[model samples]
Target chain A: MKIGIFFCLKVWNMNAKIAIQGIKGSFHHQVAQEYYYQNVEVDECLSFEELIDSLMSGKSDQAVMAIENSIAGPIIPNYALIDKNNLHIIGEHYLDIHQNFMALKGQKIEDILEVHSHPMALLQCMEFLKKYPNIKLVEDKDTAETARRIHQNQLKGIAAIASKTASEMYDLVILAPEIQTINNNMTRFVIINKADNFVSKNEINRASIKFELDHKRGSLAAVLNVMSDCKLNLTKIQSLPKIETPWKYSFFVDVTFEKYEDYAKAKALLTIMAEYFKVLGEYKNTKP
Target chain B: MKIGIFFCLKVWNMNAKIAIQGIKGSFHHQVAQEYYYQNVEVDECLSFEELIDSLMSGKSDQAVMAIENSIAGPIIPNYALIDKNNLHIIGEHYLDIHQNFMALKGQKIEDILEVHSHPMALLQCMEFLKKYPNIKLVEDKDTAETARRIHQNQLKGIAAIASKTASEMYDLVILAPEIQTINNNMTRFVIINKADNFVSKNEINRASIKFELDHKRGSLAAVLNVMSDCKLNLTKIQSLPKIETPWKYSFFVDVTFEKYEDYAKAKALLTIMAEYFKVLGEYKNTKP
Candidate 1:
């Protein structure tokens, strides 16, 4: 009995508590399950703000936050959240999104009066939903939560756009499969923690950074030149306006390189060139 | 009678039909009222897609579209919509956003059980709403529409976060004024027409352009160099992923200049520097 108790304690310690922005069977939940090998205890949050609070308060070991989607572009607020909270991204995962329309087992597509889902999910499946002009599209907080609600309430004449996992989990049937308009739908999620530089230097190949340039002409151009000279390949560049400084902007950039030394050299140069510079994260490149 | 009929026809021809997303009390409607000096007729649309259809089908003379917000960032899909539909932006307007929480007359703030509004409006007023933990926040299609519904239905416990115009138009009483977290909240709107170059050459000081660069290192830097060398001030830059070719991006840029000739010169140089370049619009600078 003593040995068994010790074994159970060790196993519990091995299980990671991962924070996600939705309930079970959500895309965020799916990411948490697929990205980690060990057993994960999910800390479900209704909003991104709540998810950050969970991480900040030490309720969870780490978090999996969706950063951007191929069809929807970046979730800009998440970037600001991560930056403001000083969270470090340790890794990333790209998930193929397949939005499925699900409802009660007895209902056909014609029987549904309303469809509820996350706004982004609803936007993605617009082409499919447009055919059923009579059905009202309502925005909900989460995709899987809606499926769960339909199941728990035994609601009729209502449907949800969610994942296949959600249908299986909530005992719902898929009315339409792969309903997203775009075939190449993908969402990139970042695994973030409170600590920085968690990954070994040699294994790191990508970095996310933010910088501000002066009002001089071609200042941005000059910075990009320095990045090019350092042999960094710019993967993504997004400019967010500084609200306090009306027209001024700060650029959030992602770069990937083959060598750590090259990234380091570029970082050193950028620190000197930019009026404000901060490294949000350095992680292994997930791209093949 | 014949003279009156001819005069009525002439007067009707002079009334410009402006297409806007949302109903009469929406920010778009306010823009329509403020931006044009002519006798204007408003064509209301529920969605941006519907607004585009109205403009494309010639149901309206031109459209007013919100492109970006000070706090919420750019409405990126609008850029893609404009680019894909080949619509030209002929003018711009800036509106100060003031979100107000309103409810049925005689109801105190404590009496409100739910709040309905556009997601953007809800987000902007989060700090104020956070204090009302018992109130449920629901997302709707438009802010003013919710206010209208609350009034029409006599919803005693329901409130809405909308503009002051909405409250006055719907006869609701404001419970909380200026609930947005930021004081300098503003939204930038663009006046789009089907025809290109509606503004004359001498008056044009700003332009919106899109370009794609080769995969070569420093190619973007090289293009920016041309703009800077030609004396153009880069105001905004947003990169949209090319869905067909994953990992590649197309940059949408806005630039303002002192002289139309300087803008013209930079446009020529950017055309030569970029692999693919297109001028999305050329209009007078609205910024002071």
Candidate 2:
């Protein structure tokens, strides 16, 4: 019956392959479904490298990657991956992450002796988990995988902290819903595609750019000053330390503008001022 | 013999109680030992929160917290922890991190079936571990604790990726020294104290500050202009999402200058320009 529903939807959204990191019912899967058509073909990758590989190799048309979490900050290595892969970020997404604690059917909260989930997920729900002193928290590779394992193994005293979709997929019961300490936690994801075919509809208010600077004193400050002069609003700035160079850093800045010409002017000045610069993406600002 | 040396050194550096985030031979322990006078009392805390608690509760005079790593990037939550706890960053230290692969004295590389370490250490040594496909990587709470457990349990066919200090403390032999993918990986640790009593010795050059801007567009850019005007070199900038507020962000910046008065001038202007501002620390630049 579920397959019938899936088939009907797949027929409606044919040939839309979206790659993400994790299995079905995972946060990435949820993001892909929500961002794109609901029944788009899902290309699941075990790791971020594979996710990018799927996109680069033409196996997947697009990819949804979690760029940062409100609680954990940016996934720095991912920025490096996207930069090195030269993938174009076409859009951005903000996911309201609600971590749920689940266990086998007929099991009460007291019956859970051990809890398992991804390390980051475990960290988010640490405050609530502390109340259950007897339950040991273990870090697994994936939250959905943990839920599936408990369901398959019929583990009587074990629970998994995952999403509600995972609980439904694995036929488990949610012992405690919304376990994350911050009730309003959110994660930002970036949508990437192989081609930079994003045509600005005069609504492109935000852009991401990466640039390298010399070891001079006011190099970055000068760039920021030019951005202000051009009427560009610097929303975010991240400094990634260059791998080979010991102390040098490459700056990634996300800026927004009222007019496209202003952003273009800032880009023109930055091209001359920065040693090396690349605009990762320019998209409609989703967050005001 | 080691106890005798420790007692003599303790006498030389009396009344120094340092708190760190792991067991005796963990990275935090090594950092504390390297940053402070050797043989000063070491108060081991299980987590970063506990480490801060030790300093706040008068159990330790100072704390050494890892702020960033070359390979893994910044430990962002620690920055939030320090900022929220109202702790003072007294100084900074850079430690060359060398992750070593070790096991029982008689074991060879091929004999090990499983490797265990902290997740971050495992990630650093991922390239090297790929060579041994048969070995399963396990993430433990602490690298030093994992080594100690292997020795205590008489566990064979199991190796641990930790520091040389851990091997010595656990009576293990180094099977492969410096197994980290990046040979020159370094971790930047901030020396924090409860009391903001660090007096500049005519060499103060770096200052870490936190500020919040009104949702106005060019507020951050304006702050950068002030820093430039004051001859302050912006070294690092990190934006942390304000938890209560949805889309707003607070910036944490580290800037260096030749003259202290220039930094004071920048601070004086920033205080009036920003909605919320705090000087996290002002210390002598140790990153030459």
Would you list the clashing residue pairs of candidate 1? none
lDDT of 1 by residue, A26-131 (tens): 9999998877643468999888878998999999888999998887788888888899899999889999899999999999999999999998898788889889
What tens-digit string does per-residue lDDT give for candidate 1 at B103-183? 999999999999999988987887898899799988898999999999999999999999999999999999999999887
Top candidate when judged by lDDT against the true structure:
1
Off by over 4 Å in 2: A1-13, A56-59, A198-203, B1-16, B132-134, B200-203
RMSD (CA, angstroms), candidate 2: 4.8
- Which candidate ranks first by TM-score, i.e. highest? 1
Q: For candidate 2, lDDT tens digit of each residue in A1-288?
A: 323433553565578689988778899989888766666678888667678888999998789999888877778788887887898887888899999999999999989889988888987887898788688877777788889999989999999999999999999999899989887788889989777665343667889899998877767777887888888887778787777566678898888888999889888988999999998988767762
Instruction: Please write out the lDDT profile of model 2 over residues B1-288, one tens digit for every residue.
Output: 323433543665587789987788988887777766556578987667678889999998788888888877778888888888898887888888899999988999989999988878987887898788789887777889889998999899999999999999999999999999887788889989776765353657888899999876667777887888899998888787776566578898999999999988998999999999998887767884
Docking class of 2: medium
